[model samples]
Target chain A: MDVLVYIEHLNGKIADVSFELLGKGRELANALGGKLDAALIDANSDLATQLGSADHVVCAVDASFAQFSPMAYKNALAAMVKERAPRVVLIGNTSMGMDLAAGVSAATGIPLIAYANHIAVRDGAVVATAMVYGGKLFAEAEPEGEQVIISALAGSFSADAGKGEGAPIVEIFAAPTGGAGTQFKQLIQPEAADVDITKQDILVSVGRGIQNADNLEVVQELADALGGALSASRPVVDNGWLPKARQVGKSGVSVKPKLYFAVGISGAPEHIEGMKDAATIIAINSDPNAPIFEVADYGIAADLFDIVPALTERIKSG
Target chain B: MNVVVCMRQVPDLVEELEINDAGNDLNREYLKYVVNEFDEWALEQALLLKEAHGGTVTAIGLDLPEMDNALFTALAKGADAAKKIEGDFANGVSSHTAAKLFAGALQAMPYDLILTGVQSAEDLDGQVGVLLATYLGLPHVTVVTGVEVSGIQATVRKEYAGGMMSEFTVSLPAVLGIQAAKQAPRYAPVSKVRAMMKEKKIEGLSSSDGAASSGIKVRRMFKPEGGQRAEMIEGDADAIAERVVSILKERGLVK
Candidate 1:
C-alpha cells in the first residue's frame, strides 16, 4: 500500500472526514503508483461498504473495538501501519484521530505531520502545508522518511471526490486485545430543549471580546432584534458565560445560518471551520487584522460594544 | 495520586507576529511569550485533582524565555514542585523533540498521571501529549474535559465534536491531553507568585538531545492568503449599523 487512510466511524456511521482523507488518499496513491487502502476498526459496523475509493479495506473487528478505546484503537492502528508500511498515512485531525495519530507515529517510528490542510507529492516526497498559531499561519514541511503520517484537518478535501461505486477487497485481521487501560462509558450528548444553533437562520455569535458574562446581554439583544439565536465561541462557553449548545466551533455546532453576526470574535481556524459557510457574515471587532474579517461579508473595524448596540437599535427600529 | 503537568510558552498572538527573515519561523525578537492557554487548563486540572485526591502536582516544561515566571506562578497556585528541562530552546523545538525530551526527564519521576495541553500554536504536530505517552509506553487520551480518580483508575470526560462527550475509565500511569478543566484556571496573586519566587526553587534537568534529522522540516512559513475579504463598513457606529441594516434589508433578512 502506498497511501492508507484510517476510516473513522462512530455509531455505525463513517465520519465525513474519513471520506475526505480517502479522496486525498486516492490522489496521493496515484501519484506514488501504488494502492490506496482504508483501515476499518470497528466491532460490528459494515463501514467498509462505503469505502469504495480505496483498493483495499483492511478490517480489524473485535468486541474490544466497539467503542473508541484509545489504547485499543492506537494499538490496532499502529499494528496496521507497521504491517502495511504504507508510504503515506492520512488520519483526520479530529479528537479521535488526534488520540491515535501520534501514538501510531511513535510506535512505528514514522514522522507525523498534523494540522495539515494541503498535501502533495513533490519529487516523490510528500509535502504538507500545516496550520499553526491557531491557523493564523501556514508551515510547509517535508519529512525525509520512507513512510510519513499526515493527519489532515476536516474540510480540507472534497467529500464528493471520495464517494464512488466500486467494491474494495476486504481483509480481516484480529484486533489487539488485553493490556487495554481504558474502558468506554456512555456518551453524553448535548442536552436537548435548548435553541439548536444549527437550525437557526441567523446566529449572533459572541467571543472573548464580550469581556464578561453580564455583557452578554448586549449580544443577546442583538440576537433578539435579528430574530436569531445567541451563539458563542469556545472561550465564552469555557468561561461559563454560555451553554455548550450555544457554542459554535469545531467542537461546537457547525452552523450555516443565513447571517452569522460575529461580535468581538477574532476568528480562529477552529471557529472558522464551523461558520465559514454562513451565507452572510458580519463581524464587529476593534482589531482590523482579526481573521474574522477574512471570512465576513461585511465588517466594522470598531468596538463591538459601540456597534452591537447601535446595530441592535437599528434592527429593532426597522 | 501523583500528577505531572506539562506546560509550554507560546508567542502571544495578541501582538503582531512577524515571519522571520529565514521565512521558516517566527521572528522571536520583540515577541511576547505567554503560557499556552490549554496547558493552563491542564495545570488547573492537575491542581484540582491534587486538591480532591490528595497528591502532589509537579509542573514541568522546557527551559524557555519567561518559563521560570510561569513555574513560579504554578508553585504559588499550589504545585508541589517545578522542574525545567535545561537547554538552549530559544527558537523552540519540534513537538517530537520536546516529547522525547519530556519522556527523558520524566523517566526518573514518579507520576500516576501526566497532563498536557491537547495542542499548542507551535506544536506543528499538535500531539505532544500523545507522542509523550507513546514514548513513555503509557496509555493516553486527548481532548479530555473532566477527570475523576478512585483507587488506581481514573474516569475522565473526553469531549468530541458537536458538543458530545464520552466517559472513559483510564488506568493509572496514563497521559491525558486536557482540553478544559471543570472550571476556569485560577489566577495566582502577584504577591503569592512573588513569595514563591523568593522562597521556592525550580529544579533543572539537562538534555541537549536534538530532534530526529529525518523528521518533518519546515520549508517556509507564511500568512494565510486572503480570500474574498469582507467589505469594510466605515463611519460611526450609527452609520455602520445603518449600513448593516440596509444589507439585511437588501438580502431580505429583515423588514
Candidate 2:
C-alpha cells in the first residue's frame, strides 16, 4: 500500500516543513517496505519536479484547496486514503499539517499520532515517538492497525543523501472529490514586519540579560555580519524592546539552525527547550553560572557588550 | 470589535510535571493551577485589541469547583468579563471540544474576531484555533505575533519556524490564535485590577447532550522515558573537531 504525506506551501513554493516531512517519510516508507506518495491539496505538478523526487504526487487543487479550509482538507485527504489505501499518512507539525492530520485521522476512523519527535519501525509495528507532558516527555506508541498516520518534528529530519541505488520514482494522481466540508469565510492577519527568518542559517538570540532596549544593537550588529536574523527572549518581547515576532520560547516559534548565538540568555526550561537544539549554541553571559551554558556547545562567561562587538568586527574584518 | 479570548487553567509551567501515579495524569498533590501562560498572553492580545479598537473582552474557560480562583486570574489579566464551563473536561472537552463549545456559545453573539493563544500551556495541542474555525466556519490563522485590525477584518503577521514572518489578511468575525506578536501585553494596572474585582459579568455555558463528547477520545496517556548516551567532545578546538567527526560517524547522524 502507498503512504500519503501532506505537503504545505506558501504562494506555490512548498514550505520547508513539507520537505522535512518528506525526509522522514522516506525513512518510514523504506522501513515499512512501501511506496511514499506526497499529497498536495490544491497544488501543481511542477512542485513534484522541484521537490527533486517522490514515488508519487497526489494533487487536490480545486477552488476549495485555494485557502486552508480544515473541513475541506480533511474531506479531501480522507477520500484520497480510501482510494489509494495507504498504510500511514505523514504530515508536518506546522499549522496545516497539524490541522489536516487530526481531522484526517478522525474522519477516517484511523488512529492519529502527532508531533512525533521520533519514530522507529520494529517487530512488525511502527514505534512512533509522540510528544507528551507539554514537550517535556516522549512516548513510543505502536497503533495496532495496518495503516498508521505519523510525523517527524521539524529540523529532526536531515536531507536525504539519495544514497539508495535508484532515485525515487515519480507518480502523479488526481484528487478525487469529497464534500468540501470546511469553509474559509475570511482571512485575518496580525500587523507586523513580515520577513523570512527561516532562510538564514545563523541566528543571534538575546535573552533577559540585555537589561535595556539599546543593547539590542550589539546583538543586531553580529547578526548583520553573519547575515542572520535577530531574535530575543520573552522578557524583551514582553517589555516591547523587540516585538513578540522576535521572541523565542515554546509559546513562540521553534528555531533550528546551523549556528545560534545566545547572548544574555538565562536558558529557562521552555526557552532552552526551543533553541538548544541548534547545531552550535554559543552563549555569552556575565553569569558564568548561567544555565544557558549547560546546553551551549560554546560558553563564554564574559560581558556580551565587550564580546559581541569584537566578534562582529572580527567576522567583518576577516 | 468585541472579542472572546479563550484561556486554560493549567499546572504551573515552571514546576516540573512528573507522573506521580506512574502514568500520564499529573499529581494534584503538588499541583496549583494558573492561567496557561500563553493563553494569558492571548487574553492580553484581546485586551490590547479592545484598547485600540474599542470593544469588550470576554474571557472563557472550563473551571472546576476548586477553580473559582481562576475566574479572578482571568479578570486580573484584563478580561472584561469571564465565563467558566463547570465540569471535569480535561479529556472529554479536549482542545477540539473546547473549540466546539466556544462555537456553540458564540453562534448567538459572535464577536468581530475571536482570539486564542497558539496553544494552551497544559495541553499544548495548538489545534483548537483551526478546529474551532472549522466548527465556527470562520477563517483561522495561527502563530500570530502581530495584528492590524480594520473594520470587520484585520491583517496579521505570523511566526514560521526559524523566526520567519508570514503575512495574511482576513475578514472579521473570524478566529485568530495570537502569539506575543510584539504587541506588548499590558500589565495589570492597579485601577484595572480594582475595577475588575467589582465588575462581575461572568456567564456559564451548558456542555450537556454530547457537547462535551463531540471529538476524538484519548484512550491512554503514556509515560515518557529516554536517556542519551553522550559522547562529550572536550579539547582544543581542533582536537574537539576530530572527536566530533568520529562521534558523528559512530552515531550515523553524519556521513
Error of 1 at A318 (Å): 1.9
Over 4 Å off, model 1: B208-214
List pairs with backbone clashes in candidate 1. none
RMSD over all Cα atoms, model 1? 1.5
lDDT of 1 by residue, B183-227 (tens): 999999999999999899999999845544328788999987766
Q: Candidate 2 chain A: worst 10 consecutive residues by lDDT?
A: A159-168
Interface quality of candidate 1 as DockQ: 0.76
lDDT tens readout by residue for model 2, A244-269? 56767554566787777788886654
lDDT of 1 by residue, A1-318 (tens): 389999988888888999999899999999999999999988854888898898999998888788888888999999988888899989998889998888898888898888898999988889999988877778999876678899888888999889887999999976687547888887998767378889999999999999999999999999999899999999999888999989898888788999999999988777888899999999988887788888899988998888888889898888
Q: Tell me what TM-score chain B of candidate 1 gets against the true chain B.
A: 0.95
lDDT of each: 0.88, 0.63
List, residue by residue over B6-96, the lDDT tens digit for candidate 2.
Answer: 7666666446555645553555566666665667678777877877889788877776433445566567876667777665654323554
Worst 10 residues of 2 chain B by lDDT: B224-233
